[model samples]
Target: MTTSATTETRTAAREEAEGHLRALVGSDDAVLRDDQWSAIEALAVDARRALVVQRTGWGKSAVYFVATLLLRSHGAGPTVIVSPLLALMRNQIAAAERAGIRAVTINSTNIEQWQPINDAINAGEVDVLLVSPERLNNPGFRDEVMPRLAATCGLLVVDEAHCISDWGHDFRPDYRRIRTLLDTLPTGIPVLATTATANARVTDDVAEQLGRDVLVLRGSLDRESLRLGVVRLKTAEMRLAWLADHLAEQPGSGIVYCLTVAATQEVAAYLRDRGHEVAAYSGQTDTTERQALEQALVDGRVKALIATSALGMGFDASLGFVINLGAPQSPVAYYQQVGRAGRGTDDATVVLLPQLEDRDIWAYFASLAFPPEQLVRQTLEVLGDAPGAMSTVALETYVELSRNRLETLLKVLDVDGAVRRVQGGWVATGQPWSYDAERYARVAEARQREQDAMLAYLDSTECRMRFLREQLDDPEAVDCGRCDNCGGLTLSTTVSDAAVAEAGEALSRPGVAIEPRKLWPTALANLGLDLKGKIATGPAAGRAIARLTDLGHGQALRALFRAGAEDGPVPDPLKSALLTVMKDWSRDWDERPVAIVGVESSTRPQLVGDLATGLSRVMQIPIVGRFAIVDPSIEPGRGAANSAQRVAAVQRRYDLMADVPAGPVLLVDDLVVSGWTLTVAGVALREAGASAVLPLTLGTQT
Candidate 1:
């Protein structure tokens, strides 16, 4: 055929595919909104592969659906969609079925499933065929399916295309070989890749790896309806209590993300005991059960779902909330999880409950980079023959690490191209043996550098939104105005003087003694044996009795210790310091206040419950006699005045806690950024009631 004739044929074929898409969707304009339509039109006009980078909930699927329909309508062969997850393929197939489109998927969930689908395509009956990337790299499947369908193949669509980029959060080694597939396809067959989230680096990587002339389309990342909040807890018990209370109040469709399968099971059980209709999904669960549970969630049989990171990638639900039970190791993960909630324009909540342990977990993983050559080599050798893929089972046979550790290591390898993924196994992409130690060392060093950068981003003290914007290379960035810190409602501040004075006055009552410990032995015991040991070793033996004499408690204890004093004199300074510390604490009640902000009103009860559970942590030993305060001033609203209200409200709440003798107050806020509101609230509490306040924010911004 002449060049012009071939061009005409290709144009005609694309137009036909567009028509088929409209017909399948049952409306000419069913798939694309105005902006989305513009994007599709641009893609169709340009024959090269293009990258569609949109925010979550922006209908990225519609772009490819429209393109497929256009091509199929023109008598093009079946459209092949390479997906990263079986759940995602099922989701798309389900949606297509609902729209009266003929779509089938080939994944492990269905045995011999692609056979019938392949037959249909050979007979020119199928319009769209969705398969996992692993399947695309399967020589047997490729040999059977591609040639039969090649004559009619219209467009190749790679969903969650970010997986093709090393910079992406969920990099898959198998995705790298997708470029080989593109190379094998007819030269004129255009490719289209779509992702909900990707930074500039990821976008570039996707284009490079796909080996296609690329066009880029990105939508706004801002989800104005989402209210972000962070909570910092001192212990695991406190985190559970927080989860229970938060789920209780929200009482809607949501997902609680845990870092491990064990954690997921534990949290789900805890929530269930608290009367939540909870479901759990983890890698440990059978695929069938997981599918049934996912369907139950979609059907509204479950009110809340607790899961590990395995659940979030391509799972879609219009949930009212998404709660992170622990801080994710990376912001990319954070954004992806939070994006699951607030799919609609209606206001929704994304709550992060960060504990010290969460940070430790991240730090631990960050420290695991730059593995020994043996470890890397073993990882590659295990991935042998697969060339770029490995099923969960296949991976287990090779790696000795726990599932979690192994997954992390595979993620690292996939990004580094030391190993690639294929159907049911991984393939060594670089030198399989230690043939080039120097080169391998250089590659390992580069990988470590990137990993370090990711860790630094996690540990940053800058605004989370600003940091993300910089990472994404978004030039027109502004303060998100919604995260814990940017909203100006942190609770980490000192209590006011007046509140502390009031607390002191209450404690100084004639009958009140400083040895409040004697008043509640059960409470003291519940403080844990660690505290008990600390007190016994440090102060309880010699100085505790004498210290009570300086405060009114000392006088009361002195009467009881008169015989001891007769036996042996106790030093005066230790006794005096105890009383002074108590008085100082009481005096600073208003000055140092703990502020707590709920991600949403629904989470207020959770904030309260977690605080109550963590009270011991705040009041024991190093933190004893400190104030425990909650500030509920930050609300989701626009404007500087609203921001000021958020700050003032936190201050006022701390001032209230400063007057209470619950212990030295710890400011509890959901999120922290610049620490300005926390500083203001601390100053206010000092001026109001607290002697001193320490700030405990859940997730630090940056």
Candidate 2:
């Protein structure tokens, strides 16, 4: 056919395809808005393979579905679809079936049973045949079925086209050779590739790999209806507590992502205990069980799902919320998880709970990429040879890499097409074997550079939206004003010294009775400190004592007594006297009570006097002899609050003032980050003369 004739033929074919699409959708008189129809129109008219780089929830499937219908109506032989995931293929097939269009999928699950599909395609009875790269590369498939079908196929569709570019987040080595396979067809078929996420570099890579003039369709990346919240926690217990509270407030179909199988199970159990209808899925679960659980989630039988990264590839449910309890290893993974929710254009929420330890995980993954060049080259070489076939085991052995490492490398190579797996082994067909090794090296290097850039972006202090835009080469990116960073919302790090001092002075009043150090051992004897050797008085003993003191249990003796006092009958005379002092102090401080107290000197008597004065001023009545005096020269035990001399003074004075009635007490400290020293001081004062002890800080670490 002449070029003009071919153009005319293609144009007529596209118009028919479009008409079929309109009929299939039952919207013949329906006029789609410009923003929505412009992309579809472009894809229909573009001569070279076109890539629709739109965002999620933008009707990308419609663009290709229409194209397929139009081509079929115009007498085009058949359209073969290359899908990355089997679940997505099933979804598309189901949609087509519902629309009364004849569509079928050939993948691992049913490739052996695909004779009918093959026969139909060969007989020109099929409209679209969806197949995976691995299936297309199958020796049996390539040798027996593809050649027959190739004669009639007209349009080739590559979904999630980013999987074909090394720069794409989820590259598959097998996808690279797709272009070569299309080239081998009897007719040079027009190709259409579509992906939800791709930056400029990935788009370029896609165009170059497909070896076609590319028409690009860009869409807004913002999901304005979604509310994004980030929580930082120091412990898993805290994370659980926060999650429980969040779920209580917003109950719906949500996903809780955990880092490991164990974590998934544990989190699921925890949520179940809190009365949530929770389900858990991990690689450890049997395929049957996983599928059942996924169905339950989709059917809304389960309110929430706690799962590992394995749950998302094939699942499509419009979740109300997605919570990442842990940071994912890559941005691709992060985006994919987030994309799970808000799939149907409804408002959704994505909560990111970043553990304090997540930074280490990021560092570890980042460290794995330093030597990825050799791995990338080798992967490409392996994949190039096989074109589209490779068994997991065979590929693993050929690369001489671990299964996991091989999978990651293959994903990257899939984009670059250094090689692609067929079914049992890899094939290399796109780039020349002798093609500049330097250029391949550059591609690998470029990927590494991109990864590094992504990592940097995640760690950045700028707005996540703006950063992502810039990464996509949008120079005019503006602040999203939605993400946590852009909203200028962060926890306060400042604590006033005056507040601490006021709390201290209020607690150190006279006439207030507080527990004494001599009685502490008795009070806390139930804590099993004796068995743990936490009560020893040697050098190590002092450290232990200091540690306990910092934990806000007062001195070692005070901590033990507090622990034991509640457990047994304590009729000690000193306890009685302390109780009396406390009663009197409470009565005296009924009005205009002091809120804080601070020790100004290292002398035990001076500290006691300071406490007595504050107590007396707050209480108005004096219950003298309520404070205990300790030797200032003695070094403070280990874990004691702050300096040994200062703690010793506070401890001695606290023991002497044991008979004083306690009021609200704030322990004043020079440094407050960690609050360890203040905690110890508060514990000591509560046992001595204060009813409640709060921390007063002069300064805190930023």
Candidate 3:
């Protein structure tokens, strides 16, 4: 075709795209931007693969929604959108309705709707169908639903496309499944991938995976309406006090990001007590509650939602402010979160309240990177030797990694073709697999560099927006004259004495309940241990002074457990905190403990002994007996050890060397990590004539 003819054709497509945009946004005045039309033309006109790298609120969704309408109007099949989060799926479905598009979703939350939804798609009654990456690998979906959908898919949309690139901040294993499905797609079917957080490297990585001739439309990552600032507070108490004193003065309802779930609960509870209308959200929250909390924020019914990373991405709200209780590990991730605010509003506040302990949290997360090659081999060997497919619970008896980590590794291996996932569980394939140690090392080093960049962001004397954009490799990064460093306005650091006192009191209020284990880990007999089914002699629910990830006594507890720290008796603060736990705990207890028994600790013996002695003195209970280590070599100290391994490590390694009192035995230890050691010891004590066992510890891991 001639250039003139091609230009005429593109002009007509742009005019048609504008009409679709108006319907999508419910506005007669709405029109498509030049780049938005280009993306739509690539899919609707040329039928090509394209990766769009743009900032938040940049109409990335408009391109797809419009493209879907054009394709469906042209007698194409339904558009399949592989979304990553529930919040994103909900947001997409709502947008589809505005465009008069019939949208349906298949996710874990709405399992009952799957069959009906698939049936509607078959009847050509649905315009768009959304499914999460994790759902793509489901047996029913992968074998029955996904294949049929992919074969006739009109357009494939990968939302949050950065997830497929390991270089991206939020890379996920389940996303790798998309790469496999992409290879099987029918020719001439268009694919569109969109994200706001990918850097230059990540952009290239995703483009290469899409196809060789993929079109790349990249844009600036700078957010003009967001005024960025960093407020370096010395402690959690000071940060909380500052927020309490200044929350109402900030912009409209916003989100307060916390690094840990325990921090979210603590901060949300403290603010609520101070009369702030806030809610806590994390992965631990149920699906129903998460939806309600999200709606509350969107409707402006609450002041803010104290949340972890679970709410960091895909949430749509024109928030007035985005406050971080602590700094994120990387600047890329930080930008994605703060981008949620100031999208629709003309001006918004984005502040970071950094503390000294943030690096410790970063280190903790860094430790959960991909496991070593040796462990991967062991997992494969176990699957190979099994007579049938093995579930994650059964595999835990042979693998040392934690359940979450193990499951993620298995998914990655499945994608690598080293294992096959069937109806029941997983079976090893005879295919040879090689571990990419260099790739793992490179990713780790890249993460460290990202951490260093984030630290630079905290103390830099340049424009905050420019600093962030440059980190994302955005060429348009320049002095925006809109952040704290660019002479823009910022929130005050002044905290009142009363507010500080209130915050301090809240932090000092301690005690996290430790629920006892109800069922034994499956397949313990495979490891030479006689344990399975329900745990009949398990200890009753207990209380800890705090969680290691807490915002209160946790700081001190973390220091006490740090490497090379001195082994001493309980600190005055923790001891006093323990007294508070005792007072509050007694109100609900049926009877007080008659004796205290210390669980043998191979790492922190002195800490365990002192904890036991102090609790015994405070309760006026005698120190009747202690467990002795019979097999000193049976050390279960790896932070990565799973439940079954922990139980086996303590099964017969310790013996009750002391006579017990008649009543309940208060089991004391330095920490309760997996709670397996306490369970083993409590079972032994119960068999030795103790009526009941109550487990207590200084700190519990969440």
RMSD for all candidates, in order, please: 19.5, 18.9, 1.6
Q: For residues 1-702, write the lDDT of model 2, one tens digit per residue.
A: 122446576556545555655665577764444544544444444424677776566667777777666556556767788887655776788777765678888887765668877777667677788888866666687777777666667677888888887566666667876766767765345678887667788888887776755666666666554555566665445566666556644436878887656457666766676677888887778766876787787777888889887776536776788888777755555666777777764567777776544544454445444234565567566655653566554444344354555665554454444555454555665664333467557655765565566456556777766665566655456776766677743432223444334323322221212221221222122222222222221100001111111111112223233322332222243233333445544444433334544433332333234444544565464433322225544443322312222332344444433343455553332223233334345455555656554332222321
For model 3, the superposed segments whose C-alpha errors exceed 4 Å read 1-8, 638-640
lDDT, candidate 1, 1-702, per-residue tens: 122446676556456555655755567774345566555654444546777777788877767776666655555666788888777887888777755557888876776666777677778777788888766545667666665555457778888888876557676766776776776777667688888667787888787876746767766676665666666655455556666555655535778887656467656765676677998888888998988988887776888778887787788877788888777766666777888888754767777776444544554455544445675566677666444566544454344343445655665565455655455555567643343567546645644554455455545555555555555566666676766667632423233344344333323332211111111111222222111111221101011112221222333343433333332222343234334544444453444334322122223335334442343344442222222344445332211122222333433343333343332345444333334344544444445544444544322221
- The per-residue C-alpha lDDT of model 1 at residue 400 equals 35
Tens digits of lDDT, candidate 3, 539-657: 88988999988888999989988888888888888888988988898887788889988987777888889898888777788988888788887764642378888787777577887
Residue 605 error, candidate 2, Å = 53
Q: List the candidate 2 regions with Cα displacement exceeding 4 Å.
A: 1-30, 33-47, 186-188, 283-287, 313-315, 330-333, 359-400, 403-463, 474-476, 485-702
lDDT of 3: 0.89
The count of residue-pair clashes in candidate 1 stands at: 92
> For model 1, where is the 10-residue window of minimal lDDT?
536-545
- Taking all chains together, each candidate's TM-score versus the true structure is 0.59, 0.59, 0.98
Global lDDT of each candidate = 0.57, 0.56, 0.89
Candidate 2 weakest lDDT stretch, 10 residues: 537-546
